[model samples]
Target: MKLKICLGLLMLTLGGCSSLGVEPWQKQHFAREDMALNHEKLDLSLDDHIYFSKEGSSGGRAFAGGGCGCN
Candidate 1:
């Protein structure tokens, strides 16, 4: 049915995305300290804060929320 068609298309798409085997040295330019997952701590903190206030969930916020009406 529709599910089978979707699954087959997804499989074909993923199969075509396979890499052609690049050596470690060839990828050295992509492996840098400044190109890290989190290059700035302050920007990450702001994103977390926005997620917490909007989603009613908070963690890694340095302090726990009080058991009150505030989210």
Candidate 2:
């Protein structure tokens, strides 16, 4: 019984990992414009400009604007 349970668990783990990666045929779907990380360059640039203007600081930070915006 122990051997059967271990084998079942191992098979389940392996089966779960077998489909973890993207297949070659699915590359076309993943390469679509809607799937991009930054889909709109112009809008992203404009947002970056607004963020910089409001926060008065550049990258390397996470929290919203409130303090002197140093660092």
Candidate 3:
């Protein structure tokens, strides 16, 4: 009986978190250009290209070394 009550309380607590997310209509707000995670896509790509080229390695955004000591 005690275990059943604890499980019910836990279920109710978990169910309360379901109301915390965004609704369907609110999605459109996030889809706007101003809400983008990366506003300057092209510029960022160009910068990355320049940086990688100067680095002289095909390393990515990780802790990849430059032209030397990349292994």
Candidate 4:
């Protein structure tokens, strides 16, 4: 009961998703190697450290998130 309510509250607080409707050619520029979220791997490590310390999330080379531990 309490857990269910807490889960619902958490989901509601997370906000809804958005879609850019991007296409293949439209993503060409964003596909560049240097356009990655971690082009030099330095920010990747820093982000991972922050995430681990605050959210307990960990992953590599992927966009993952669904309220799961692997996210």
The global C-alpha lDDT for each of the candidates, from Candidate 1 onward, is 0.69, 0.71, 0.70, 0.66
* TM-score to true structure, per model: 0.45, 0.46, 0.38, 0.34
Off by over 4 Å in 4: 1-18, 43-71
Give the candidates in order of TM-score, highest first: 2, 1, 3, 4
Better of 3 and 4 by lDDT: 3
After TM-score superposition, what is the CA distance of residue 21 in candidate 4 from its true location, in Å?
Answer: 3.3
lDDT per residue (tens digit) for residues 21-44 in model 1: 587789785688778766786887
Residue pairs of candidate 2 with colliding backbone atoms: none
Provide the lDDT at 3 for model 2. Answer: 100
Find the candidate with the highest lDDT and give its number: 2
lDDT of 1 at 6: 100
lDDT by residue (tens digit), candidate 3, 1-71 = 99999999999988997867798887997889977867776876667666766666554644443444322
lDDT of 4: 0.66
Candidate 2: 10-residue stretch with minimal lDDT: 61-70
Provide C-alpha RMSD values for all models, in order: 6.5, 10.2, 10.3, 9.4
Model 2 lDDT tens row, 1-71: 99999999999999999979887987997789987867786886666657777665555433443434433
Per-residue lDDT over 2-67 for candidate 4, one digit per residue giving the tens place of the 0 to 100 score: 999999887776643233357778888898999877697887766665675567455656543344
| 10 residues in a row with least lDDT, candidate 4 | 62-71
